[model samples]
Target chain A: MSVMIDTGNYIAAKAAVMARPAVVPAYPITPQTTLVEGIANYVKTGEFKGEYICVESEHSAMAACIGASATGVRTFTGTSSHGLLLMHEMLHWAALARLPIVMCNINRVVGPGWNIWTDENDSISQRDTGWIQFYCSSNQEIFDTVIQSFKLAEHEKVQLPVMISYNAFILSHTSMPVYVPDQKDVDNFIPKRIPKWKLDVDNPITFGNIILPAAYEKVRKDMQDSQEYAKKLIPEISKEWKKQFGRHHGDLLELYKCEDAGYILLSMGAIGAESKVSIDNLRKEGIKIGLARVRCFRPFPREEVLKLGKQADLIVIDRNISVGMEGAVFTEVKAALYNNSDAKAYGFIAGLGGKDVTFGDIEKMCKKVVNGKAKQLEWFGFEGV
Target chain B: MLSKDLVEIVFHGRGGQGSVTAANLFVAAALKDGNKGVQAFPFFGAERRGAPVRAFARISGDEIHLRSEIYTPDIVIVLDESIMDMVDVLKGLKKNGRILINTTKNPKDFDFSKKYDVATVDATSIALKHEILVGGIPVVNTPILGAVPKIFDRVTLKSIQDTVKDKWKGEQGNKNVKATQDAYDGVEVDF
Candidate 1:
């Protein structure tokens, strides 16, 4: 492995190329443009041996991916904000049909206000799309997860699509030194996609045809079964990667100082990384606060959340809201602990519209809960709860 | 949190001044110096030229886990001195922090020299002298990086020259390295 100093998008681009995807269909968008550009550079330099297609729109990009992936070849693509939202329908199609397509979605804020900054709304809004969601905090994790996603997605036990999300500029444009493993090692880690099924012209078969209600329900149930299997397989793959590369960013969840603590802070993306500073500062002040950075949002990690809830109170700081309801993670975490454990969890809506959720802001939220002064839910930095 | 081993620096310049590249290249040099952790990123918004822009970098003796922007910087670099007119370049500088500017005048000319350590270099003139022009405008990012090694001991002028050469090859690379050397020699500091 060699250390490369560059931005997150470029590192992810190298990882994607190293994974050796057969086809890439991409469209440009803010914060996501550099990532695709990096891939194109690799293709021009002959490092990438794939059919790189320049699609018209975000919709066509995913459609092209679906078309290529249905042929039983590995496929990868990336986008952010509106681009990911535009592929909403195809996202469902890829997952329902069990294509192991992998993508990187830059976590940018949704529009109408025309703001292009870091927020989790883009990927969080696609929660029910049946894709395995992974939120990464560091460029190294982005690099590792992009490679690992292909392995996890294409696993026989879990043949589902994967979406790797990182904060817009906080991660997407940030430069850090990431250790790029040798191609031989990466190829050994992620072998060619030996799919169970595919479309062949010689032995033609129907794909995504109309189905009856009973068959459709069975498909949905099978997806759930695969997700549960994914929860078990994610850690196994992560462990193997670590054994090979001497680096692992955790699987399902990355815990920081959470072995024994009364209060545990919960978050994802860049804020999850910044929470370590808050935890360190709070620990110095005699607060037994730990951090459980949610790495995987689905299969929801209910078993893990239940375990954490049984141990300590959870304070969730979510960067995405469900409009009329509270923060998305808070809603789900509370449900995980409902009647299952006696632990209490508080929710704070923050970083929406790409507002800076600094370590100071995170510390303030944790202090409120530690002092027994927080409500069930509050909009951070807003006038009222 | 003022962790003793970490140093944060913010850069101020115009849209086309390469402030973002300055941070990136500067941190790359620091990484070569064997620092365990380094980060560089730009405060991105609109893409209008001549608008005040900012970039940030951090150097640490250990691995860096914090991902927030540097709220309080230990050093500030100004690629375009005129940016001071519209932006507060020293918004959150630490006490006795250093501020480097690309100005023709001596470091004593700036009132900020009284409070913070000041370093001045004619980076614009150096870029022009080496004919480093992009779209017919002097590119000061590389020249200012030359002065960085003078302030931060962890980064060396040799490392910056090597990094620049790796980014731009042949005649372009030689021109940037020579411009960097000139800026390093021309820097005047009020310490």
Candidate 2:
């Protein structure tokens, strides 16, 4: 009668994908290993009935998934920092071909010095890769997002790949209580594969062929059109998910107590939860502060952000850096709020290589809001060099 | 709301101290008791040794909804005392939360007695006494778990014993079963 509770993101991910009966193709990568490993264990123990392919590398993993998804079956795979980079070429093709593949990416910092901890560099770097990316802050979001990813990616107007990421080591290894919906409810929420297009042997349609300049522009334009059309479908799917699951996070931009607040703490991934705590503590102290959590990053959610920016001062806290270009997220946030003349936004870079973000750091940031002095681009919890 | 009483327990340690293995063993104990739970580790992208790593276990009677990271851990188990200076392991620990430290040192060595009920055990010595190699299976978590009833009045040693027997099947299972008992027997209190 009630929902089943579970934890450990890997098990939730495995149970979700298996319940959907996906044809999974995965390879082992640190952090991202649990999802594929759990699925393998399920198939090995005869608990789940799905074709779990053990590939050699991240590249082959996505390639196998692309092939499987084109065959008209729901497909799944997972990867991390460099693993995602390795799949970069295939990711573009997967999106261009309009295959609805759902992937779980355990957000890890891409390395130049061989450091492997939690960071948003991997998923953030692929921000413009034509896929619908959703950053989940919790284990439950990781589970629910994967389930919603299928519907969003397979929608008639949006046959694109989707990735749901949570910070590596933070949410990946953090064991918190999570609610898993029943198989019957999930099946009802997402009916058996209603793909927009499939590799129909009888229908005989061509795919991924060479295009000359004359027709190449049209193909590219169509891809752009599909993505633009997806902006509307995202909220539509979120509405459906709420109708079935009773929780709605469908906004391109979700604001927290920003109605009366003068300053807004904007962050993606898991830090948003930490920001909420900071905001709550500050609010109790009689300071009006809020948080805007970005759920859909791919379509940029530019319109939703502009609409929300009408009320408050924005602070963008990014876990990834852009080297000489301010912060990666700061640049994007500024661009999103560029047209809004009434808003002033600040940027912060923090949490690289799995560095822990404590409540103290968040409280300190809130103090800046209380003081009414905000920087253009700053690093949280970092001191003098 | 009749929500499930889900408990989040975290283990902080160096790479080789058996924190992860201990967490898994605890899950096995819980699962053997017919309770559903998840055992997992935070594998830092780099697999090198002696890095400060963490493992987690979530045990509950009902489905959990707050799927966020365990910011406020109900129980904090320290396998290696050296990690205290690197990160704030006690940051969001609940007031009067149980702190299980695997050490020969007294609880006076650490500050903040008001926030925690510190339980010390010479688990490394116990593991060595039982001939569990430092590089081998982490046998300290179970023995430290023996002190659970003392720290928290909810879980019982009998529940843990039944859990170990259910998880570790057969004769080899019996050694671990004895190991659980020996671990409970080995709890050393440091005031």
Candidate 3:
């Protein structure tokens, strides 16, 4: 039964988290702290089982999570932009060790001059870390994806860390209605599946040992193969999530109204919701436009993304920039559609450092891109006027 | 969209103003009258003193479908006047929505050029009379919550009472309940 309960997004996240259950190891940071507090609170109240480590820093948090997961425990943690940056070095270890850890990344803007708002730069910065990444638009999606992340990560074919990202203040602070499933239902659906290579005291196993150059390529290739396997396994797990939870996730990459449309706007995070409004308004005004929300950014849904650009003029909007280069998403979009002769990709860099990318900005940008006059690396709604 | 209608109100205030506690009171009162409701605070950036924050309440007979921010808020209670200047607080207010401002000054003293109805209450004075701490930041949100049912007659006092009892249980909670009651009794309603 679908019950629409009006809950704070943070509370919903916390409730879903408690139900799924995890041994949390997290440190507090702006925008992302409330989530940490919520999880910590649960641990303190004995509502959730497992050790809650008050780690020194983001790096230690990931390390503690790695330790917990390696020992065959369901582990979880969270961090934001800079904290994710600190955990960068440990991400490689977790992926190499193939620990099926789940993490919540409250996506915030990375800075040259210290700013704490919202952006995808932090998560996008670690695109090559071999962790499966999912971007959530709504609070409900955040709750749903966390449940699915575990299933996807723990699968035999793909045992890797998963990071679910949502814009820090936008979705994190913004209150919303979240439908929480019955705890019994979640347990029946998620059912604890310990991996084959679990750390057992009776049978000791070394994890993340120093690799010699001779065997490094094989180890790297195995990691690569696991990621490729995840590309397929994600759908299988999502299928189960739908049957149990009644939420059909479109694909690794979800396209919104792109069929037969002349122009398409590509985005991730909360911006996708805004783009929907822009698309609807443009449609009313006789403009054929659509939105493509990148649900899974890592183990990138290459084929689906390429196909999205096939029938329409593609405009890629990335909240995170690649410094010196255009937005990282645009580069990936271009790479996806490189061989597709029919598709032309336009890049729209927007919402850096918590700047509110309004529906009006999206409409204006789409108009320019469709007319073939939009500049590459164009910052949406930047004030010059 | 039920026959009675779902009006999701968001109250923006600081930590000490009793915004969250007041919101709980409102939800309690609504639920007592058998109206389904919810009250929740935003994922606070920091619970530091004098920091801007918000809490929400979704009230209706039927379940709520709209999980997003109440973009077109039916009612906006600003406990702190400074919040109005900080953000576009009135951006998506419904045409006929009401804004209750808790301040020491009169309604005319503050700008109300917007088309919606603007009401002001000197909650500081009422709170002072009750010997409620008035030296620090004022607990204007409680009085505002109490006075709101009068402005929006659809909201019953009994519902607020129920929500308060269900949510807030301690002496502090009881004090808030009584404070809300005093606020309800003290509405001047001079428009």
Cα error, candidate 3, residue A360 (Å): 1.6
For candidate 1, the per-residue lDDT at B135 reads: 95
Q: List ranges where model 2 is wrong by over 4 Å.
A: A1-9, A19-22, A212-215, A248-250, A382-385, B1-17, B21-138, B154-191
lDDT string for model 1 (A136-217, tens) is 9999999999999999999998999999999998899999999999999989999899989999999899988999999999
Q: Point out where model 3 deviates above 4 Å.
A: A1-9, A12-16, A19-22, A210-214, A382-385, B1-15, B19-76, B80-97, B103-116, B125-138, B149-162, B181-191
Q: Write the per-residue lDDT of candidate 3 for residues A74-130, one digit (tens) a residue.
A: 888888899999999999889988898888888887877777878888998899898
Per residue, candidate 2 scores C-alpha lDDT tens digits across A1-385 of 2333233456456545644656888888877777677777778787667788888898999999998888788888888899999999999989878888888888887878776677888988887778888887766667767887787788777888988887776677665435567777777767788776777988998777787897978866877887778788877777877777777754666678888988777788778766776777778888888878887778777776676678777778788886777666667777878856578777777777777776557667667645765466667766420
Tens digit of lDDT per residue, candidate 2, span B22-114?
676565455445455443444344434688877776666643323334677788888877788796788788776778787777666667655
Report lDDT (CA) for all predictions: 0.92, 0.71, 0.74
Worst 10 residues of 2 chain A by lDDT: A1-10
* Residue-by-residue lDDT tens digits, candidate 1, B1-191: 44678999999999898999999999998998898799999986786788888999999987788788888899999999888988899889999899999999999999989999999999999999999998999999999999988887899999999899989999999999999999999999889
RMSD (CA, angstroms), candidate 3? 4.4
lDDT of 1 at B3: 64
Interface quality of candidate 3 as DockQ: 0.22
lDDT of 1 at A362: 95
In the range B1-191, model 3's lDDT, one tens digit per residue, is 12247776778887777776666566656655556534343533456667787777667775333333456678888888888778666868788877877776655565663566777676666666554574554567666776788777767765665555565587655665676687677654445
On a 0 to 100 scale, what is the lDDT of residue B131 in model 3?
49
**Candidate 3 local lDDT, residue A138:** 72
- For model 2 the local lDDT of residue A200 reads 90
Fnat by candidate, in order: 0.84, 0.18, 0.08
